[model samples]
Target: MASSALQVFGFTLGVLAWVGMIGTCASPEWRKNSHGQTLIDNTLKYEGLWVSCTAFVTGQTNCKDYAEFFVNLPQVLQICRALMISSIGTGFVAIIITVLGMKCVGLGSSNHIVKARIALLGGLLFGISGVLTGAAVSYYAQGVLQDYYNPSFAQGLTNVP
Candidate 1:
């Protein structure tokens, strides 16, 4: 009874994590202006994996997709993009495997041991997905920090907290 309960719990958590991965991928607030209340309070600048934008309190906003100038992009930005996408893909596969292996679903092997192994495999994939996400976010954060602190890099601008 306990084993089945654990499997259900793991599957639920994995699904939630997968959804979160997708949300993060779609979010445009990966980075934003450090000071929202600047002298030019009308404009707010922010950036994400795919695009960057500036917004005005008056409901005006302008955005631009990341340029295809891959060579000029920061290594951290490049790596983060790759890793974030990978995490989403891996998480998706894990979710499908987990669903098939679920005892209630009975879509795969009937043997308890086989089902358990499949669940374990899904769990492992979930773990890898989480690790990749952490690495990507951390690497990007490090770059933001370095740039923020270095006057020569950002001038008066700093990364959003």
Candidate 2:
């Protein structure tokens, strides 16, 4: 009974993780920059895998989707996009497999050993998805940091005098 309860808990957590991953991937505020109240204006900027947006203090926001051509995007953006998409895909597969393997689910073979192996494989896929997500976020953050510290980069509104 205790093992069944644990399995349920684990399955719940896995589903929540998958949902969180989707939210993170879809959010437009992955990276944010705020310009202090300058004489000209105060604005907030956000950049994400799919779009860039600006918010004005007057409660107005404007967003623009990325170019249709993937090749035109920066290398870091390209790699991160691929990794995040792959992670989502893997997580989806993991969810299906986990449901089949769960102790409470009767969709698959009744053999205990086979079910255990399937559960293990599902767990492994979840781990792989997590690793992919981490790599993508870390790589993107590294690129952002490198550009932020480089005086010569001269990109983004943050560099405005």
Best by lDDT: 2
The most accurate candidate by TM-score is: 2
Once fitted onto the true fold, the runs of candidate 2 whose alpha carbons sit more than 4 angstroms away are 154-161
Residue 55's lDDT within candidate 1 is 85
Report the poorest 10 consecutive residues by lDDT, candidate 2: 152-161
Superposed Cα deviation of residue 17, candidate 2 (Å) = 0.6
Estimated TM-score per prediction? Answer: 0.86, 0.90
TM-score of 1: 0.86
Candidate 2 residue-wise lDDT at 92:
95
lDDT of 1 by residue, 113-147 (tens): 78878877888999999999999889888877777
Clashes of each: 0, 0
- Candidate 2 local lDDT, 1-97, one digit each (tens): 2377887888788889888888888888778775777933478888888888888888899999987546878787788889999999999999999
Where is the poorest 10-residue window by lDDT in model 1?
Answer: 152-161
